[model samples]
Target: MDKSLEKSLTLWLKQQQTVCAGYLKLTVLFGILTGLCLLAQAYTLASVLDGLIMQQLSLLTFYPELIALLSLTIFRALLAYAKESSGFIAGKKLRAQVRQTVLNKLISLGPSFINTKPAGTWANIVLEQIEDLHDFYAKYLPAMMLAGFIPLIILAAIVPINWLSAMILLVTAPLIPLFMVLVGMGAAEANRKNFSALQQLNGHFLDSLRGLRTLILFHRQQAEIDKIANVSNDVKQRTMSVLSLAFLSSAVLEFFAAISIAILAVYFGFSFLGHLEWGSFSLLPPTEHRLSLFSGLFVLLLAPEFYQPLKDLGTHYHAKAKAIGAAESLVTLLNIQDSSLTSHITTSLIASSKASHTKIDLKTWELEANNLKVFTHDGECLLGPISFTISGQQKLAVVGASGSGKTTLVNLLLGFLPYEGSLKIQGIEFNQLDLSHWRNNLAWLGQEPQLFHGTLMDNLRLGNQTLSTEKAWELLAKANIDDFVSQHPLGLKLSIGEQAAGISVGQAQRIALARALSRDANVFILDEPTASLDSASADAITQSLTKETTAKCLLIVTHKLSQLGAMDTILVLEKGQLNSSGSYDELMAQNGLFCQLNAQTAYDIDLQTSLGLNS
Candidate 1:
């Protein structure tokens, strides 16, 4: 195994105390019963042979030996069943516990961190890799412990009767496991690569499926199919290579084990035939002789069974390698540190510390930014060194072209990422405030609203679960979606597909707006919430928002030139730099870019409206 994989495996095993100990005990007990059964079978065979050789073959005379063999077989089967059942229980419970722990990590990591990871990778970790632990727990690990302990038991049982046979068996048995360790390591590496390829293929397939419409529009469907086919072929080739390695390793182990057992059989047979050292105890067979022969034969029979566990272990090694690769990725994802303005939650996972610190020194009501800087992952600066403030329930409109860092600014304030320089709310340092509590005091509606797999009411309940159905209808009435939701046969029970596939984009936006309103947060950030709605719907939403019931701060980011008139203050951003800031007339009076841009926007809107081209 790779060093990292070995370390992780060690960590995983150490943590599973009760489960591992239970499995170990059960396995040993089963192995003991199985070894005893082999002993009984060998002794009965020798006793019956000696009786027949001496012309004393009678079923009634050998009744005791037959009964002993039958009892041992029955007990061994019962013990084996118990071992399997206990293993199943342990595997199930451990999978559940580990799964819950992983989920908790995902939840605590929050959306920002999760967004950075691929959905396919997350699916593989949670669904596939965690499930792979079952094979190791239920099958391979038990057999490994048995492999080590059973050989010693067999050697001890035969040592007194025939030391030469015991020596041969004991000396050569370790060769199988040793050879496995050296040759099977390659299979582990190949299996890890296969799993990674599989994950990439899955990710590519899902992404293509999601963007199938875009592919058809661009006439790239056949190209995508060919690309996926190539990935499939690569996966198949890698899988076959890994399985071939497993097969070769098993064959090697079988050959070594069979040869070792054959050598032991030769030594025992020679001694019994008076061609080798006929010790005083060994020379007493044939009705009164060969007592030692019975024990040696029994040890010989069990020697192969002992090595069979090792062969099975070789196969599981391949499965376990794939599982470990998936697990390593999962551990990294689950342990991703949430280092933003949001509060950090620490846990005893990964090697990282759980320390929560805050930037203190600002008050909670005064908004100010000093020398702020934000950079993208690729090292391109989005915003920087810009200072501004919004105080006392003020409404500010942020306007700019599409790529001028408008959304990036909102992300900064939402505490999704870290920034340089100082940002304060009410003079309280933005980082010092408890982020979860701070977020609870804010509500946001982005250009695209996210809806999960649930009913409209069920999704809405995420905002305020205590709200009654009657109250929900009232909120929907305000957002102008009451009729649409009510018209459905199931009404509140009407199910939405994943990502709100059943709803139009406009309706999804309305539901998001309703969700924000339900929170009743002190600060509301609307990032072009009306971007997708129809004219009448947009007008109704803007009107409803304007009639605010509470004194709350509002910041709206929009490219809707017509909506500029509604803002108490309008701010313009150009090339990530704030160019103009003031009330509508105040900026337009200066007649800078803001005035020129507004004029061009109005002219275009008028033309589109006249030509019946605006959607």
Candidate 2:
């Protein structure tokens, strides 16, 4: 990782600590208490040994010290448990906060931006990548703090007993973290590659599953399987590389700690044998400078405890690297600025500007567009500087060839895309209105109706949960699917599996239409609602839509020119510009794009009939 980027990620991670700071503080407190208990336990054990050897005391005479040691041992265990529990709580809260933040950002970006990436890519980031951050909060952060504080606590107790042993510990302590950082630098890079590979695998696997039917129809399933296997293998290799680096880091820390402890043990052994004694705190003469067994035993007992924190820190260093790797994707997504949806004006101002606020009267609503153009993030125009007007209770159809920006125009109206020039709703600038409020006044249906896994009643009442069962039947009747739903064994209780698994596509579209009508929106926008339906189903939907939207403004984007003849006004688009705008009969009379589109539609129908595909 680059130095600056690493620093930024570290800062970002530290900032998130504020969300669960109390729990984290408790973790560190319990850890410090555990360290104190270790110091007390070592002292009591050292005193007992000194009394038995130097004072020639019996085991019965040291009952108090033995009992104190036992009590300290149990207290240390309890403190350790509390530390872990606090860390777990802190990690859980932080993950939830971060996950909600990511979800909110995705929602604000809207479908226009979200559709740019595969569904699995977003799911991977939101779930697996966020999960990888757990250990950093739960283990690494508290350990980092304790690694500094605990080692110092041990040194404080050891220094007075033997300065040389304390100096040895101080010298070796820096080495553990130094090598840990060196190993972690490589580990961080490996972890980053591993996360990237996992994201790719997730996205590819999900996309393959979604397109499995198409792949089988073309006899390409085997090739897709091979590709998936290759991606999975790559992820496995990268994951192993990360694990290898983590193990290497632990090995390095253990090697240095064992060497440091061995050196302390050798010093104590020599001092006990009267070979060297100046390092110990004894007041004997120069030639008879001898170390007491109590001091030597105390220093030796605290030796391993001194290096324990640093070793544990080295072990959890890999968690820091893993979290930094996961944070890369998270930060990138959260930092994305969807300039189109952002507005400096407050919602209150936007709402208060109109007397009726968000609740505009549906009967008198008017939409006007002048020189309207939609632009991509790069400022490239997707929809042109065209103009149109929709007045009270008007039915308009926008017809165009593929890539002619028909969907872009609808997206602009739905507030999913930003536009330049004048777009006004009831004389108010469209951009100045609160989007959430604006969306409430509009209902939309796309080519593929998104029916989730739920009962028919649950799906229908999505926009209006308080809707009565009687009102729901009325909506189904309006969409012309009441008979089909009523005939089912469960009626409104009928369960529609994910993506309408048990229902035909036409029936799903009708159910979606009923759900949309349940919103009682002032404006209705349908984009190819009947594109894949049979003639009978399509005609029924068209008739239901015409009847239901009679009192509301309707805009339909379609290629079937036959049903469009009844549209009050039709706008023909070629490329990104509007070729012409008139009634269907008026456009048919002219030798323009509309006539060519109508001729193409007729040809497609004849071709389908001859092939018996329409049956």
Candidate 3:
């Protein structure tokens, strides 16, 4: 084996000591079985050969050897079956355990970690890489160890009969492994590259699929196809390179093993033809007696089996490398720190001595954002150094341009992201309040609602797992979606296609709104909650939202200028800073961006009507 390859394998094995040790024990047991089975099979062959050479081939006389050989063969098959079953089970157990550990960590890390990572890459890690470890842990590793050990045991047994034969086997045994290691080193590198390329391809494919509609609208369908093809081609080339390396490694190992066995055969044939004799050591002869002849033939029979494991072992190493590459990515992702401000918040619902300064009752929940400023990882500023407060039974509207950091501010308040300043509940700093308790008080409706593939009832019930059918129907009614949903033959039991496909955009939003209402939170943060609706639908939703806000702290983000008039307080944001905070009349009096933007919308409507463009 090349020195560098040997070093790499040793280092890799050491890092995986605990998991590898379990496989080692299994391999040891398998090795013992293999040795015993081979010895019995060879002994039976020797007995049959001895009888045949003497012209005494009687079934009755050879009955004991025949029966013993039959029993060993049966035992060997049983042992092999047990080993395979147990190894597969162990691999499965390890995969599940590792995947579970990573999943728990990812959940704690939450949205921030997810935002930074490509969803496709995470999916590949959890699904593909985790599954590949099965072959390496269950089959290849154990076989490799057994292959190495069994040969030595066979050599020990055969050495006393003919030192020359034993020497040849011992010396040639190293050659197969040496060739395997040299070839396998190149394969490992290729495998790592292939695995990386495959993950990138997956990420690109997912990204393209998610934006297919947008791409088609821009007349970029052909361009998207070209992009996908590029990624596919890269993956294909890497895969073929790895396969080629594996083929070459297998060929080299097989050739060496065959050549070594042929040389031994030649030596044995020459010795027999020349009538060679040993002048010394009656116990160890250069020429074969009946026992030596039987042992040599048996050794020859077992020779190929000794090298077969090494070949199989080298092939499995690629699977191990691929698994490790995936595992490494997952581990890094799971190691991400919970950088969210919510991490400091307690998870309990009940207010205690820690929350006393907030002056909130155990059942009361109020939220306040105090001069909170958020920045991206690259230090691009998001939300304000502006203060805001929303006490019970108040509705606040945050109006801004497309990129004016409205979502960032809401996320900060929700404790999904860390902030520069502080947020408090009922006058207490947000960090002191229980995050889980705080979350329980909220019903958030994002512009794009994510409805997982399932029945409508299934998706709705995800809001509160214990929600009764009666409660769900009531929520659907309140969200104004009950009429549309009930008209379908399947009603609440209808299965929504993946990500709520086969449903209107407005319906999807309302379904999510229904889920949020079903939770019965004391707080609601709606981001463009009426964006997908027509004027009449928007009016109905606004009325429902306004009624729901009577006893809760409501924070809605919108670009719809007319909705600002209904809010108790209208907070206008511009260039990542809060511009105005007051009633609509007060903001209009200031004649700032809010007034100008509203005026522009009014003019556009009037112009469209004059040109007969209004719907």
Candidate 4:
């Protein structure tokens, strides 16, 4: 591989070693002990064979050596078991740590980072990419050290018996690694491209699945299938390339190992035939330098052992390449620094702010802003240079067309996105307060409520799980879904699909409302809550929204302009700027954006109804 990549991989491995030092030390210790056991077994077996063949000693006479061999074999087995079990634990711990690090980094990057990629791309990075590093930790890293040390131990045992064979083994060992480096360069690059292709294919397939209905309606299903197939073919080619290089590297190592072992055997054969006097350690006359059966057998036995560690090194070489490929992405992700904040306004500064020092928890919760602005990653403004104030238990509606930044306002309030300009809560800077603490006091319900696979009771208890069953039932009654839930045979224990199965979207939204009520939050922000509901459901929800915030501060973002008549204030946004702000009648009297949106609702409702009927 290139120097830069090699250095990066080395650095990353060293960092991992530091994180998992105890386990890796255990691995190396077990590995070296296993090598010692192998030597004992080999030496004992050779001694027994020599005793039988040359001295004509009885098999029964070799009992002690045989027992020693059996004992080493059992100990080796136990060592192997411990190595494997410990390696698994180490890999699990590393994977969990890496996954959590990625999750935390993603959170620090916020929703903008999430919006930049497809769900499957993130899935491939978070799940498959992290999982691919398991072997790197469990095997490749420890094997790297063992591969160098174990062979030296075997060579030390052999040099006294047959220095020539040890010399041959040492000379040939570098060729395997030299060839490996050459082969591994291509394999590393191929593996990286393969992972990228797989991620793209997954992302494309996921996007297609999410938009399947639209594609079907437009008669583009066959086209999508063909595109997916092409991406699959690309992945197949990339995978084959990686495998070919890996196989080639393994073959090269095996060939060199086989040659070294054969050379050792040949030298022992010639020495026994009196063809050479200098091959063995004894340097007397030709007859004196002759091979002793035990000496020759032991040297031959050591040949494979000398080459075995090198052979293992070849196996782990591919793992190193794979890890290097994975590390490139990991390094890039970890290096991301949020550019939105100014040079002095660090994330740590914002995070360390105390909420308890402020009067934000007062009964009269007040929010004041002065020219708040939000920007996309590319520096394009998405919201603001607009200002507003909200106080007491008031219901307010923010209305705008698509891309006008209505949702951005709520995102700012929820602390999902950062903003410029002063936003104060109870006369204290909002950014100076602990956001996680701030968020707990404010309830947010989005366009869709994420209901997991669980009992109805489990889903409903989401907002305030500490509530008693009877108390939870009361909140459900307030949400107007208690009657339907009570009539169901399974009652609170009714099983539901994750995708709002066995219940309508309206019911899911109601369950979300009930969850909000259970929390008994002082502030509630609803983002297009009834956007997906039918007219009857929508009207019912609109009516519910009016009554839902009797003693709570409610902020609503909706295109349903009719519902804003009872709202304390109606804020109109046009192209990220605040166009108007007043009650519904006041805006109508001004003949501003509110009246224009009111005029468009007639067509919107008609178009929606027609589309609904057609579908």
Best by TM-score: 2
Candidate 2 off by > 4 Å: 282-289, 338-363, 377-380, 426-429
Q: What RMSD value applies to candidate 4?
A: 3.6
Give the TM-score (vs. native) of candidate 2.
Answer: 0.91
lDDT of 2 at 140: 94
Candidate 3 stretches greater than 4 Å from native = 1-24, 54-59, 111-120, 206-223, 274-291, 338-362, 365-394, 413-415, 418-441, 565-571, 578-589, 596-615
Local lDDT at 188 for model 1: 52
TM-score of 3: 0.82
Q: What is the lDDT of residue 175 in candidate 1?
A: 84
State the lDDT of candidate 2 residue by residue for 1-615, as single tens digits: 787988898789989989999999999999999999988888889789988988899999999888888889999999999999999999999999999999877665557667887888889899998988988999999999999899999988877667888898899889999999887776777888898998899889999987888999999999999999999999999988998898888889989989998998888788888788677555321234676777777777888888888888889889889999999988887765433223321211111223244435557978898888776533567888899999869999999999999988887777666567888878887767677777877889887789999999999888688989999999888777899988889999999998688998778988898888888787899998878766666777788788888878899999888887668999999899999999989998997889999999889978987888664
For candidate 3, lDDT tens digit of each residue in 69-184?
Answer: 88888888887777787677667766777677667655544454466757787787778876765676677667667777777777776666666777787788788777776776
lDDT: worst 10-residue window of model 3: 344-353
Write candidate 1's Cα lDDT for 1-615 as tens digits: 478766775476446536456765676577667766766666676666556555557867888877887887788788778878877776787778778878876654444455665677677778777787776677666776777666676666666666666667777777877887777776656866877888888788888888898999999999999999999999999989878887888788888988987886777677667677543245334334443444555556666765666666665665555556556665655544533222322111111124233333222366888877754422345776688888756778898887877887887677655566677775666656656666667788877788899988888988888878888888888788889988989888889888788888888888888887887677788899888765567777877876652366788887665666667788788888888888988988898988877887678667877887555
Model 2: how far residue 44 lies from native, Å: 1.6
Q: How much lDDT does each candidate structure score?
A: 0.71, 0.83, 0.71, 0.79
Q: Pull out the clashing pairs in model 2.
A: none
In terms of lDDT, the poorest run of 10 residues in model 2 is 344-353
Candidate 1 to native Cα RMSD, angstroms? 4.8
